[model samples]
Target: MKKFLKIIAIIVSLLGLHSCSNDLEMATVTKPEDGVFKLMSSADNVTLEKENADSQTAITFHWDKSWYGIDTPTNFTVQIDSIGGDFSEPVVSELIDNEKSYTHAELNYIALKFELDPDVEGQLKVRLKANLKYGVMPVYSDTKVISVTPFSTLNLKYAMPGALYIQGDAVATNWSYPIPDEQTMVQIDDHRFGLILNLVGGKNFAFITSSSGWSDPAYVAPDSTVPAEGGEFIPSGSNTTPAWGGTPMRSPADSGTYKIIIDFVEGTYSVEPEPSIMAVPDELYIIGDATPLGWSTGPSQKFTKVDDFTFAITIALTEGKYDFISALTWSDPAYKAKTGSEPLMGGNFIESGSNTVPAWGGSDITAPAPGTYTITVNFKSGTYVLSL
Candidate 1:
């Protein structure tokens, strides 16, 4: 009988141990509550007003609920920085009484200011993050970019004398001009300089000049007077005639100071078209500053060839006035002659007028008084034409 009692006691002890293990497992399965918080206002971006000497813009932040499901969070903090990174312990705000929202009244009253380095010239990243109790990790939102621009100054001056002009054929001349301390005089890129000269009714001449030193004597003029090294002269346009002016004759030995001279004869002058036009094929495509259409080169909206020497395109421009010129893509000779490099057509976007022709090339185009505009392609050319 004693042996039977021992077996029963062992079974009861075993059952009690199994029940305790099941209770511990149930407690482990239960999850802890999550911390609650949310932004009171819904705004993606904000631009604060400029602060005055004594007043600043104010902002408020409200939490969705108390931290850790508690009715009140006694200790709260706020921080700010111009850059986002793994910052050290940040400057914390003072702890306030138990509340769901905090008012930044101090910021509203004091002037808010920041300074940027002189070398930076792009958007700066600013970030704000927060921390709370209840095993919650720090929460962050999108960063903001603040534009920073550097300062600079520019100075301009004419590098050559204003009165300088071309004279005798192949004659040399010298010019004295002031230059900025920071800038240096270099050869003109296109071997040409801006010149203002009055051509006689029947006179033509060719001139040559260089940026190197000038050692040879200046070429002579048709008149008997000696030609000055830095002065103007008239050309006789005759190869056989000897130079009568006192101007010095140039030899192979002279290579220094650059020279330019003009020849005068009875003739009319004509402006030459760009050489690109000659190379364009009979069928060519043009666009850009040379065309009436504003600059755009996408596949959906591009210049299309209409014929051997014509093409068309369409664009939506702002209501205000604008300017454009003809520009070619790849080089082609045949069509270039008809199109030429000059601006082919131009016009205004008006509310109502000559619907066929909007405006003249180099003229202003008015926009609709105030409404959606349906701009049509209405430009034509003798050698070349364009359509919508």
Candidate 2:
């Protein structure tokens, strides 16, 4: 009986060991072979419209399932580049795990990064890369070429130019009176203005459209606090009411720095603490043969601060090509790529460095013609436009 019991215990131990081995089993991973992974979709031309930009998928990419020795998860990424160019400057878009497609809006946004001419068809090279895990070799599928038409979403109707100013008892020079020049507001659009000023708590203020003369089209706040962005205000008794009796906006608890934005179209105003006033750079220089100075930084055109965040330069640009750079070198920090509407336009001021440094060296901003143009750079808004 002792020997029988001992044999039974041995059998139980062997069965337990078998169960543990099965639980710890791992599948054999097979490294994907190069040719096994390929794009399954046809190279069809795609056209994306700016009107349907929201909630739209630009294009869907399909690919054959990657085959490794065992079934394991794989990451897929879609890369794009200018036609016939290497992938060195490839614009990487979608990165998904075990997914097969990307949306139109996603790809459309990526296409804009190329800065393709509006309403023009441009060829782009597309390819897919699949990887199993870190420290593992990634497999690249054959490149596919596709044609795409791109458009700009910027609407000229919503953008315009005009001048604005601050007034009221809260201001030092003009207490309850209008002083246009001393407190003139910088024009953002035909109706909007960006104003930076210091105020005394509990003091009341208002905005006057005129520089020298006071009048009816003045902006008044309804409450003690300034209006927020999209806050609406309609002047009451307009040309009929006393200017001082008109509604006035009062300062907040503590007086310090403030940024005010007034929009006339929507009849709104927003007041908030100035995050931190950006000191207007001592001097902003324009370089290139396009300028009358001809690439000389010293004789470079000087910028006049219209406000704490705006600068303006009115000069004759002789044609060729030009850019705004902090200094006289081909590197950054330089302002390039004048996009938006014709006549009035804007671009980004990219920081310094190579392709690795983001937003550097965009296309040169061209002059409408070989003549003088009034150029304004609003660092706060990240926009620069030329005016006649």
Candidate 3:
């Protein structure tokens, strides 16, 4: 009887082991079924008010928590694309944390990035993507479509010298850069304005603010001699050129696009004609509190020209603030990143605008640490890189 009982016990133990193994296999083989998920919002159309344009909470998105029957961690990504645009390209793609919402400023910036016309209704498709851990396929919820209108109060203060015009005998038209051309010289600061123009040699030139005619005030040599560096512009009512026999400045002997630097504080200006065949300056430099130069405009670090439109530089940047300029003097034709990110080698190049005015047009580039870095800017491609 004892032997028979031992045999039965062995058989029972083996059968129990088989059943345990089957249970383990079943656990591993389990897969989650598709869950009914959807994205919801109270409002379908949101008109962004300028008052709430700041970095305030703009909108919130709610969705049903997906159930995979397991405690697998999941991630949610919010993607926004223009209407009729497929997921292939989304204007705004961001990962949402525990709180699923975006700020007004954030949305406004995204709208600007999407090139949405201001005050015009634009349609956008928003969708949520849920990713399951441990190799489960990512689940996508139904898209939520919404209409949004964007507005910007970013009124930039035009630096001193509100407007500038270039008129010369060498210029076929009386007004160069044309009337209302973006090239018109504007104040960069209280003291200076800078202009880059194609100047013809041996031609008489003069500075004027009004494009109506030569009746406006003009800048002439202090001694009434051409090519003099120091001069003062007469008041608007004065006919220095048209009535008082004022002298129109003389152009250099060689013809080319020249970078003209004017200092209102010192009442002085300098002309640097093109050094090569290119019309624009071949190099650009950085100046501000962040640079070692400390706005002294010196021995400014130089940018390397990779191509006609691409320029780069590498140097140790401090922890404060900085800006880029075409020359040493504080003036217009300065540049700032366009407030975004671009893929660089190890990191991203903060994007910037070309030849921004007022020196403070874009956010300052901050150094994550005091170290040497390479900064590259491409105007044609509209990209910039600051990498260590």
Candidate 4:
């Protein structure tokens, strides 16, 4: 009995020792040191453009995880405050993951509201720390400075005639000027003006003037010179002339001295109108197995009147056979390729045979292939006949 009791005591001691060893191993399991954090702030100065009264600026912070030997960061934290101040109680604290760079535009409105305070000026420091569990210590990025300026001032000087005029048509006169930077507004009289200059790296300025007030103007970096003619505004290519119109400025009749001020503020570009796509009558609509049978009624199909009878349709097509028919009025005698009881052969219609249709119909008539096809009509006192 004494020996059995001694044996049981030994077994209990061994079990306790094994359990303690397991506990120690679990506690020593450390997180990977590969986790690291970095922060980058764009733009040393933040110019809250005139239009951004709400004080919402798009600030971007970028960081890299490769430094820490991690595939990607699981999460990140952004702390922003007045320079050199602790961000533990920051004016703005943002938590983000899935992106190495975070844009302030996506922050909560309350955070933005706090940052927009007028008192928030000077070097705004943005601290970014990434959280990754692996090879190295949590890497921190260098402090970024964002100068919070209320407004940005842009100086406009006439490149050609040293003298600048507050009012009158600068476009009509020979004036050379630099393109306005985006977010800069040029004001003439009570109205705002836009740039119309068409030289390489050059911009033209035009502003609307009224008896009372003027509109605010903004300068956009000139991508290229404005074309001379054609109501359409496009970059000047080798063959096109540069012209400016469509945005008409009211002529100031009374000769009065006015001041022209150019202000630069952050602003958004106005949406441009979509190009028109219209089909002409007496024109053929073609489609094949790849195209819908009733493609004429499709949203992509449209007819626009270039003249009384001439119409145009712009379409994008893939390589395939297409079937088409003319949509001319049945009673129109000028375009009739066939008569009752007499089947009109393909030779009876006109074919251009690979020539692009002229902008307007006149003596120009293109021949067609050996099949029934529709002939384009001209409503302006002229008849268009299609002959093969």
* Model 1 C-alpha lDDT per residue in residues 159-210, reported as the tens digit of each score: 1221222332222222222311111111211111222122222222332232
Taking all chains together, each candidate's TM-score versus the true structure is 0.22, 0.37, 0.42, 0.25
lDDT of each: 0.30, 0.61, 0.59, 0.35
TM-score ranking, high to low: 3, 2, 4, 1
**Displacement of the residue 106 alpha carbon in candidate 3, Å:** 1.6
TM-score, candidate number 2: 0.37
The alpha-carbon deviation from the true structure for residue 123 of candidate 4, after best TM-score superposition, in angstroms, is 1.8
Error of 3 at 101 (Å): 1.2
Measured over all alpha carbons after superposition, the RMSD of each candidate to the real structure, in angstroms, is 21.4, 16.8, 13.6, 20.4
Better of 2 and 4 by TM-score: 2
Model 3, 23: alpha-carbon shift in Å?
Answer: 6.7
Report the lDDT tens digits of candidate 3 across residue range 1-388: 9999999999999999999998876476333343356778756787787775565677888775543455556677777876776876575444535337777777776775566766788877888777765535677778888888877534422223456666667554645444544235534333556555667777776666666555345664444553533345433335343554456676677777565656655666666642222234556887777777877566547777876556778677777767677776754545544342322222212223343233344455555567666776654323355654
Please list the residue runs of candidate 4 whose C-alpha ends up more than 4 Å from where it truly belongs after superposition.
Answer: 1-38, 50-57, 91-121, 133-139, 150-388
Error of 4 at 254 (Å): 56
Please list all clashing residue pairs in model 2, or write none if there are none.
30-69, 57-104, 58-103, 58-104, 164-185, 168-176, 169-176
Report the candidate with higher TM-score, 1 versus 2.
Answer: 2
On TM-score, the leading prediction is 3
Model 4, residue 75: displacement in angstroms? 1.3
Give me the displacement of residue 353 in model 1, in angstroms: 79
